[model samples]
Target: MGTVVDAPAVVTEKEVVAENMLGDKKVTVVFVLGGPGSGKGTQCSNIVEHFGFTHLSAGDLLRAEIKSGSENGTMIENMIKEGKIVPSEVTIKLLQQAMIKNENDKFLIDGFPRNEENRAAFENTKISPAFVLFFNCSEEEMERRLLGRNEGRVDDNIETIRKRFKVFVESSLPVIEYYDAKDKVKKIDAAKPIPEVFEDVKAIFAPYAKAT
Candidate 1:
């Protein structure tokens, strides 16, 4: 943690270009992170409805990229299958593209920058998150939710879910800690019922509310 990690020069140049492009639009990105079944998608939808913000799920975007058969699609697909984190460069590029394509200035980007590589590479983008919304829930509860969600997703099985949870604790927690160190994380107790949890979320996002 003490030593600095540098991204490749090419990554930096590309990210800087993206930074300059998004910078002109004055983008506001809020990173939404949590375990697989942590209700991040549900809450992000609520935020978008109540606030004038776009919701972009990193996983969804990657999936879409795969479906579209983009050049990086195969790599992303393989990584996802093995539960490996995709290169931060690819995810960041997708995020930048989404941000640029949307008309909304503020966006809630769900499920990204889940490791130190991501955290470090993101520095070059210069499109810093307004804050990170961290959802905290018990593994037991998350596991139950994942089993019952019936999404028919490949990773919804108990084996994958357990592995994902372990990976989250090992990798994602550090990203949360980094943001916490910077005082840029809003922790939400997601173990509660959906509406009740949103009530708390609404309070944190009150300032960003849009006129109804």
Candidate 2:
């Protein structure tokens, strides 16, 4: 018998947007990846203010979906509660919608593509990031920040934070590695204070700042 190979899985409607929609637009995207409590949201806010880029946090969008009582809200809430990743289809849809709705063409997408599947999905959809800003922080420091944040996030509890850390190390770190191998990762030490960290972030973003 001849050898046979399976066909690739069909791309979902969300994946089609991932592959084709953003690429067709004149958009510049920077992916902000980090362990939970690594200050991704904080630095992204600074980037938005200084560089004129829109800040799109995947987590925030999902939370908003939950609050809006979307059909997927219950499933997303459950996944979040378990410290599990939401499906890429759901996340990608939210991201695409946000990008289209916003007026700015430059965006800092924070806390997304949290696993290899996510990375692959985005890549397949044709959404290549300009670069990945990796917030490198020790687990001890991250744990301290999350515990002290007092933001009342359901996932801020120590147990859930630990699970998030584990997921980052196992799932998210590989995405950084993939970008690193391509010389497309800008690694930042997130253990420092906010001002010091943004100082470093500013340097990486200087060119974009000039363009804006």
Candidate 3:
């Protein structure tokens, strides 16, 4: 198992207390939202590697279910291919169970709360992130990257790609707006190269990057 790092002093002083007051809990969750190929996954990896936070990727969880050959595996795989979100209860349950099993205070939850209903469910569960990281990339660039991803997944097709973009515009926009209104959203330009993108992400997380 990897070693856990010490919580940053800034986080301890600023967010920890307030977050504790909100739930009287120790966990610190940073929710990240972005459209397909917006670099959310890459940034999450960097955050976990540098900051020692647990990374909970919703997309990965869904993919795992699809790979499990369970009763819903086929259906889940089809949904993912079409860029449609899985049901909230299913995903929220998965997230809760994962968090319970891990027992980590710091978490970077990637690719979650895709729609308003999904966001509300998380909020209803009394789970709130210290802040949200939103990746803002142009539509053209996003399409370009998604096409290039060529992950041989069902969702890699052009029809589904366009559908995903449309769904993202319609369903995910309000969630971002909500976070923006609360003044807890950090927008990152995800159109740049991976290293440059990570540099910006690193700066956002520098306060928490010290090795414990």
**Best of the candidates, TM-score:** 1
Of the candidates numbered 1 and 2, which has the greater lDDT value?
A: 1
Question: TM-scores, in order shown?
Answer: 0.84, 0.81, 0.78
Model 1 TM: 0.84
Q: How many residue pairs clash in each candidate?
A: 0, 3, 0
Candidate 2's displacement at residue 76, Å, is 4.4
The true-versus-predicted C-alpha distance at residue 138 of model 3, in Å, is 0.5
Tell how far residue 116 is off in model 1, in angstroms: 1.3
Question: lDDT value for candidate 3?
Answer: 0.81
Per-residue lDDT of model 3, residues 1-212, tens digit only: 22235456556576534542223346778889988889888888888889888999887887787888976778777877898767788788777767777756688888778889999988866668888999999988988988887588888778888898898999988998998899989899998998998888888898787668
Candidate 3, superposed: residue stretches over 4 Å from native:
1-25, 65-86
Residue-level lDDT of model 2, residues 14-59, one tens digit each, is: 4655543463576888999999889888888899889899999887
lDDT of 2 at 209: 83
Distance from true location, Cα of 181 in model 1, Å: 0.9
Q: Candidate 1: lDDT over CA atoms?
A: 0.88
Q: Pick the candidate with the highest lDDT.
A: 1
